[model samples]
Target chain A: MKYLLLALLPVVTQASEITTQRQEELIYLLHQDCGSCHGMTLKGGLGPALLPDILQNKPVEFLTATILFGRSGTPMPPWSFMLTESEAEWLAVYLKNPKHDEK
Target chain B: MLSLSLFAVEPRGTGDMGIVIERANGSILIIETTHNSQLYRVEGLGDLSHASAVFSRDERYAYVFGRDGGLSKIDILAGTLVKRVIQAGNSIGGAISQDGKIVAVSNYEPGGVKLFDSANLELLADVPAQYADNKQSKTVGLVDLPNQHFIYSLFEGNQIWLLDAHNPKQPVIRKFTDIGLQPYDAMVSNNGRFYIAGLFGEEGLALLDLWQLDKGVQQILPEYGKDDPKKPVYKMPHLEGWALTDDYALFPAVGHNEVLVADRHTWNLVKKIPVHGQPVFVIARPDGHQVWVNFAMPNNDTIQIIDTLNLTVIATKKPGKGVLHMEFTPRGEAVWLSVRDEDKIQIYGTEDGQLRAELPALKPSGIFFTARAHQSGL
Candidate 1:
């Protein structure tokens, strides 16, 4: 039980590092800024879809790395200048399991 | 004593009417320029995330091209959806032919241009973007030429094809391959002669003279920004946003914070005007007195106006965040701007640079007017 609690501590700590307002802003950036290429609904456009089903096979670490350092040959630009490593990881997790549809 | 009739039709002209895509909701606001008010809210358009519109010749109807391949013809006078058809799996935009008898859509998914009978939205012909191994490439930079001719660029195929669709069933396509690395978008000159495509993977633009098709695609300003460091483009520059004057042409330099000005006749690089961030849209006014420019992310809120006579950015205005698009009025008296984050369509005087009016909108991206019906390559 102690190991289980220890294993979950990092995930909670990473997510809690982002404030509520910053989380909302990140979500807006996901739907608007990232949506410019990936479609506002994340169905797909120039870039591929980001829907859970489409991204189910892609590992979260791969997506987070791609988010931080874009693919070299494609039009997907790097977001490292704007996003931190942990923030990108949080976004990657959020993309895999979106919670904004709760409204 | 006056006799009133319930079936009497109101006398009106559609030149003052237009449609604004409510992008998030898949709805449109039927608006008029005179009153600046929405007449009706038409709904059920599929995936208007990157929607565009083209007006019929009569200006009574608008054919809306949605990102999800939904082609809808709306009656501006009646304020209702006349007809709609999912022509492809995914589409970027569309164009209306010179004769107004046909409508051509540029698709991204199935990778081709599909023509439809403008009267009733019936599929007429399909020109596939075929290349190596019968692989498909997304079509872009679609523009209609003067005599039922259409031109488009293939992004992945690295080619441009001109389709002569005089006959709805049959088309004579002229393919110009090896044009550039990645031709993202293209535009035809106002006089209907030159077709220029902006390359996404290179430093210059691809040019083709319609009058002299035998020469093939010519590279212009092949090294405009060769020495500069390429910045990551948040949004690709719209070639349709280029402005051509009598003696010069001003367009955005891809991945660079500059607007390249070239001689109109010689196509030689005249000067590189340093600007704020990367310009996404560098459009000219109707009279060619001034040019207005808007940039990509981080600097998207600012608009810079240039003096065409002096070739300098005379003024700059920050009209709130997310300045997605700008459209000049018919006579160039005023320009309408879509502020996405602010949820407002702000109007500004072209000459004075003053806030003329403001209209409420829900994340408006493109603000197209009916006046585009008569313009070439709008």
Candidate 2:
């Protein structure tokens, strides 16, 4: 029983470490790329405000699509080429639950 | 005798100068045309924002055109916003009638001119402009003409439209063909005889004979070297400079960087005097012998002084970046220049070209000064 518990603890630690790394990467990307139009905090700039709680109920898939395809008839231009599909998906997840696992 | 007083904002690095004359009884209105807008009131000048700032013949009210298409009327003596008129299209350019009864604004999206009753900010009429091509139009420049008429310049269409506001409900539109590649601005001489328009694609001025619109509009001679076509064309005529005098008409040319002296009677480009880079706007001193040219500099900021008598540049003073527009006090004691990129208004001595004061971080696009006589209810 003791040996089995030790093995499980190592596996749990590794998963948490990976999750932390991904969160850091997502925040860095948003600050660098989106800060110009959207405020660094994503409050608002030339673009509309995008607070975490306000967007929490929004579908992650829809958020990814908007980021990749962009809103037509507005100043938002498409960023499909700039971001990979997986990266866009991660951003969507982060935006939808911005306060998740707060550091 | 002319004197200069400088009003410098404490911290220097802010850009652009946005200033307005107050309509309230005892204060002046000044705003910084920056991303972060700041508002100021002149102690004795009255509340500028409350005044309907139309330069009408009567000079009683201020006509305020908001960016969101809100027009307001302010009573000068009462220092209060008197009325709010019907909303119009987005206004980037505006002008008041010579008689001061009408206000005209150049709308952006709908791409036309909207005339408003100056006293009430009431919608007089909407005159749709005709474009040579099916292009989205941005009305960039407007000038008031004599006889209840006004001229508007379009950004996309690159044309000029003359609107007759004689009947506010039905405005007659007269299009001047082949005025220039892109007509950015138009100015009618005080006498109402000659109208000069500026081109963004050409190197010279477009001279229109108001008396004879049927005759071909005259393309005033250009002063650029044939090889340099890419140098941005003169964006506005009389941009080089214009002084209100009964006898002679003076204009500045950006391409040649010189003031073009024209015979008011004959409407001929009699001579040209060389000036500095991109002379944005000019103000004639009350003496009428010297017209101040705000020279827009790429590397440095400076104002070029021109001797109206000889049509030559006499001196240059460094004011700061992006000296795009200027206003002379009605008394001609000081000249207020909008240093756009720097976001400040630099006040200068009209006689010696000295920096008297600087108002930093104003995103000012236009500047105007009310004549003292007009203020005195003359």
State the DockQ of every prediction: 0.55, 0.04
Off by over 4 Å in 2: A1-103, B1-53, B66-68, B76-79, B83-89, B132-136, B154-159, B222-229, B232-272, B297-300, B339-345, B354-365, B372-378
Those runs of model 1 whose alpha carbons end farther than 4 Å from true positions after fitting are A1-10, B1-9
- Reported per model, the fraction of native interface contacts reproduced equals 0.30, 0.00
Q: Could you give candidate 1's per-residue lDDT for residues B1-378 as a string of tens digits?
A: 133553576778988878888787888888888867788888999888878899999999999999888999999888889999999878889999998999999998889999999999999998889977979999999999988899999999999999999886898999999998888889998878999999988888899999999999998988798899888888878888559887889989998999999998989999998888799888999888889999999899999998888899999899999998898888888898989899888989887899988998888887788998998886
In angstroms, how far off is B340's CA in candidate 1?
0.3
DockQ of 2: 0.04
Cα displacement (angstroms), candidate 1, residue B31, comes to 1.7
Tell me model 1's lDDT, rounded to 2 decimals: 0.87
Quote the positional error of residue B123 for candidate 2 in Å: 1.5
Q: Compute the lDDT of residue B133 as modeled in candidate 2.
A: 55
How do all models score by TM-score?
Answer: 0.95, 0.61
